[model samples]
Target: MSQISEEEKQYVVFRLGSEVFGIDINKVKEIIVYQEPTHMPGSSEFIEGIINLRGHVIPIFSLRKKFNFPEAGDMGKTRIIVVEAGNSTVGIVVDGVSEVVMISGSVIEKPSSLLTSTVDENYITGVAKMESGLVIILDLEKVIGRDMAEAI
Candidate 1:
């Protein structure tokens, strides 16, 4: 029998309000500054709709609206963190992208009670303590599960 090897993953960290959130780095394709998204009528409000990304019409998602955060107007450092969700590639608008961080499967921990009240802890992989404070590791698949659901 062959021994199962753990897969390594990288994460791209970005900020929502003051809190830091990280998504699978592999999901990220590129990051762009804020640009108005062409609205898709009848689509879910969370989806900011498609944008012309390098001649490819890629949909954009507002993470703030996704997590139910109060609307923040005109961020000086807003960026679109491009992510590929399943078959389609999409860009997610975030406040900004911090440096990429590493986390091994062995070090990943379950979300604590603190995140539960804030948002579903299941959406969080674990809490990473940093000298700056704490960074909440996010589960992109669970959070963006709605996209595929809507397609059906």
Candidate 2:
């Protein structure tokens, strides 16, 4: 297989609240419409629950709850972004799924100290400057840490 260079990377953008975030397109498996997942007792608060997708059980996580944002009431635009990180396949709930875009490495900047402190510093890989506005790039593995990844 041919390797894709860092500069040629593409991202799947999604919105959590008013803020926008992006994940490497390579890590995204698929995007699915919102569905209520079966609640699992003793699971993390951020994790909505588990859902059976094509016979495979997948854990569903809520970005809003994880980021401590106010609960969202609208489900019309909500989407479950199924992403593959390592050997685990999980889904993250986002307010909406935005368009995919290619962002050159040169236009990506390290997360500012202010941004890192406000948002979770651990998950942010960088900030990409787009014509519309800035988009935060997230590292999937970091967002769902090793422990959580393995557990779910």
Candidate 3:
């Protein structure tokens, strides 16, 4: 039981197009319904803009656009997952949030070279082999860090 618990990690699963991705649950703050953000002029293309959440203005980025996926129009199922990336708080827009699942570390595998070449490998932590399908675990810090660095 101890061994199982040690190997199990909780992830917040979300969808982008048909692909599923996950982030460490501990990094997530909250999930909110899709809301149009106030447009910020001269921001990055991937940035949807900023929204005031409980008095704190949080910038929202579209994972689909960042990943170069085609724009999906299913706004009803869309969600914004607020997460802590490095020292700052940011929100990532996903197609939809599925569930929080506990996956065993033993079943997590290093991402393949093909996948790495397609998408910046730095963003990928690992790929979890689930009974339904694979869930790519993302390092949001690495993914958002580059953009933040560029802005600075």
Per-residue lDDT over 79-99 for candidate 2, one digit per residue giving the tens place of the 0 to 100 score: 999999778889999999989
State every prediction's TM-score relative to the real structure.
Answer: 0.84, 0.91, 0.91
Give a tens-digit lDDT track for model 1, residues 1-152.
12112444677888888888878787888888888888888777778887897798877877788778888776888999887776667778888888887755554456767555667776787766555666777777777667635732
Can you tell me which runs of candidate 2 are displaced by over 4 Å? 1-6
* Candidate models: Cα lDDT each: 0.74, 0.84, 0.84
The digit string of per-residue lDDT tens for model 3 on 1-152 reads 01222378899999988899999999999999989998888888878888999999988887887878888976889999999887778889998999999998887877776766546777888888799898998988888877755532
- TM match of model 1 to true structure: 0.84
lDDT of 1 at 142: 73
- In candidate 1, how many Å is residue 138 off? 1.2
Clashes of each: 0, 0, 0
